[model samples]
Target: METTAPIVDRWGGGTCPFDAGWKKVMMWSFIITDGLLFAGFLGGYGYARTMATVWPDQSTVFTLPFIAAMTFVLISSSATMASAVWSAQHGQRAVAVRYVWLTLVGAVLFLGMQAYEWTHLIEAGATLSGNPWGDALFGAYFFVTTGFHGSHVLIGAIVLLVLGINLARGRSTTENVEMAGLYWHFVDLVWVFIFTCFYLL
Candidate 1:
């Protein structure tokens, strides 16, 4: 048997908590803070919906099948992003790049579908101020919530494009792909909330 002195001072400079890299820690921090921001948005939307004298019926306003397709595309992108990270970790740079590209394509397709949906709504007189539907706040909340989520998807697409290029050029690391995947997956998860709260409710 060997005797050892009691250890203290977990914050010793040389060690990382949970064995996570600085980049991963930072990404998680960003995800948490960003998630809070979305939570606030949804909270406000929920309160408004409950208080309104007349909330628009979601089914009458949206093409559920088309939105479901968009959701499917976004979820598929998350899977491709996970594949990219896995491939990068396994030293399959070419496969990683390909997966990243596939994920980007899915993001683009989702955005395009969103754009079409928005255009149709606007043409039907939906605006940030009001809509032909019931509650005026319906239009406002719908645009703001989905717009914020769409902007995140757009940013994820840009990041994936740059990541794919760097990966192909041998300038990207497994950690880089992993970070992008984390962000992309967060974007997808947020959409699930938005879809359920705004579209399905």
Candidate 2:
């Protein structure tokens, strides 16, 4: 068996041990694990939908145009997040702060839309304990998936706020900004799937 030696480089000439690159890798690993968990949940959702005597019509049960607008907001936020990362990397702190603010605004808007949707659904007689749409399965899946995604979005927003404060105080480094961006991007990616599966399909 062969052993590999640890790589080293001169100080300031190589990437720091706590660099953006390493943080991005860790974020990717986290996203991959999260994706697997979501996949299983979605598969189970699909199975339940198929097995149910009456599958809820997504188009009828969900407000399509409203969700579509929310989707657009999230996707645009992803773009802003990318710009923030770029600005941070290039040492443009002001631009980075602006982009982070925009991203945070987008997150707030998305959450508001989700709240509206939840309220509307409840008004229409959907409940976690007793589903009014099709069956208990319908309500169960609806709450579990959307609720999980909403929780992620909430966490992402909090992370963005923290990063924003750090940037404003000149305490945030490029690596910190990049790590936050990575987490934000993952949240957006998960929502894309959720929108497609829950609303469009």
Candidate 3:
């Protein structure tokens, strides 16, 4: 009788098919799902815009210079987040902590500017139901999309604060800093899309 060979389990418990850490994999999964959520929101906004008899003129409804400043701050935060990750990877914990704090400051500034913008719009009669702008759906879509993105920024800010403290205390790892960078970059990318499709187009 011929002896049978035992088969090897290539994907056993110790294996990672993607060759990435569990934290990175989980963060990527979250990013993908969250990206799809934004895509759906933008798609609906586009459709509603085309169907509406009157969509607000972006120039008339938005302060381009102010929006540009907000964009600059968020993009700067992405850079600082990247620096933090790089510093952590290089074992420069003190520098990493400083970068994390800088990124957090950028987030706070962006949120403050956004709040000021929202207050100005609301005072001008912009709301979920209607607005002084051309189309009513315009107000609904604008608030919903931007608000959702702002909520993500807020969450990112909180995470950054925790990560900063942990880094300073020697409780955080390079991988943890990298994951936070991934999240911050995703938020920045999403804002670019929103700025283009919603504000520019």
**Local accuracy of candidate 2 as per-residue lDDT tens digits, 47-81:** 98778798778878887889899999999999999
Model 2 accuracy (lDDT, Cα): 0.87
Candidate with maximal TM-score = 1
In candidate 3 the C-alpha lDDT for residue 12 amounts to: 47
> What 10-residue stretch in candidate 2 is worst by lDDT?
1-10
Record all residue pairs in model 2 with backbone atoms less than 3 Å apart, i.e. clashing. none
What TM-score does each of the candidates earn?
0.94, 0.87, 0.93
Candidate 3 per-residue lDDT over residues 23-54, each given as its tens digit: 99999999999999999999999899889898
Model 1 lDDT tens row, 1-201: 123221223344556645799899999999999999999999999999999998988888999999999999999999999999999999999999999999999999999999999999999999999998899988888899899999999999899999989999999899999999999999999999998998898
In candidate 2, how many clashes are counted? Answer: 0
Q: In the order shown, what is each candidate's alpha-carbon RMSD? A: 2.7, 4.3, 3.7
